[model samples]
Target: MNDALPREIHAVLIPVGSVRLLLPNAIVAEIAPLSGLEKVERAPAWLLGRMPWRDDTIPLVSFSLLTDANAQEDVRTARVAVLKTLADDDEMPHIGLLAHGLPRLITITPDLLVRTDGGERLARGTSAHVLVRSDQAIIPDLHWIEARIAQALPA
Candidate 1:
């Protein structure tokens, strides 16, 4: 067996309502518990609210909104996945994903990742749709999502 392959990447499997989000461990800053959030006026449905994260107000988004599903759980029991922004803008360095529960860690190899659905159409906020360990998940388009947030922000 050749021993030149790179090490398996560590990732976080977070549940956003019914949909799962597979995110690189390096991109996720923290999984913080949800508290009272500061709601923004005239914001889109996906933009739940802003919460204090690392001395900044980060926008918390709902995955269900992107897919037209309802998975919003009890607010008192919700958690937020704090992710580092992929865009070049600094005004919003980090964004939060509303997770229904705690996120679990997983190690992944290239061979284990597979794209199904015959190249399913990826909507906005979605990048790639793949199956991880037989479970389907959508790799969010962080860059696109951030761009949407940037446009949604008030002047």
Candidate 2:
């Protein structure tokens, strides 16, 4: 077993289906209950829609949808996690992550993590290591998420 102690990640546990995801606190800006979102025509299926946030409107994507998990049946009960992402130069945009249920703050222990195996992966594929609790908590690749937004949105 690796002797390295796990760094405690102050994360927000966003429940999606039976799984609870530990998202880095730094990335999370705010969490809001499901609300009005302006649907974009011809947008990707994964894109939930757009909503007014702070000053500018932000695009939202279902976390389950992004991971290719089951589509949420209770959109009314779902919540949106606003994530701060660096844009052109040094601007930060608040992008929303649509997830089922609510968010909880938790501490992750070293023993609860495992190194990922080298092989085929899924959409939103995790890194070489993941933090697990009652369910597997894959450490997300923000760069991957950012790239997806870059491909879809204009500067």
Candidate 3:
């Protein structure tokens, strides 16, 4: 006798290398063309560099490289996905992700997403492996990713 309608969530599917990341649309600030990046010295390979956005310079990271340390993908033609940081850090309010192309907006309902991990190990910086409709996407661990970015940024 339960007749409640399933809640729908607005989300975005961002292409990073060969993987597609599913994230809430609210967290995505902007998807801009990849521009010149100021290199960060002694930073990890996952940390691509600092990119200029609006009036502040934010760190740009390669999600593929962050998940798999050995992943190598050319970023010369990548796009920048500016994400609003969740942590309450005054110094770093946002971070950029190196996306392969423009992200696709999708509406997700409870029945539309299914957990596809199947007891398999999830990648680092990833919360879960899910199948949204016919497409498989990874839910990124944004908190963990933000912490990693904060630790790698120069003081």
Q: Say which candidate scores most in TM-score.
A: 3
Q: Write the per-residue lDDT of candidate 1 for residues 61-131, one digit (tens) a residue.
A: 88778556454445667799999988765788899988887787889899888877577676767888888
Put down candidate 2 lDDT per residue, 8-125, tens digits, no spaces.
8677777755556667787789887667788877666667778888777888876566666565535677788898875542433677877776678777667755655445564573
**Clash number by candidate, in order:** 0, 0, 0
* Model 3, span 68-93: residue lDDT tens: 97899788789999999999888999
Query: RMSD, each candidate, Å?
Result: 3.2, 4.3, 2.9
lDDT of 3 at 129: 94
Residue pairs with backbone atoms closer than 3 Å in model 3 (clashes)? none
Q: What lDDT would each prediction earn against the true structure?
A: 0.83, 0.68, 0.92
lDDT of 3 at 46: 94
- Model 2 scores worst on lDDT over the 10 consecutive residues at 122-131
Candidate 3: residue 130 lDDT (0-100): 95
Give per-model TM-scores: 0.88, 0.76, 0.94
- CA lDDT for candidate 3: 0.92
**Which is the leading candidate under lDDT?**
3
Candidates 1 and 3 compared: the better one by lDDT is: 3
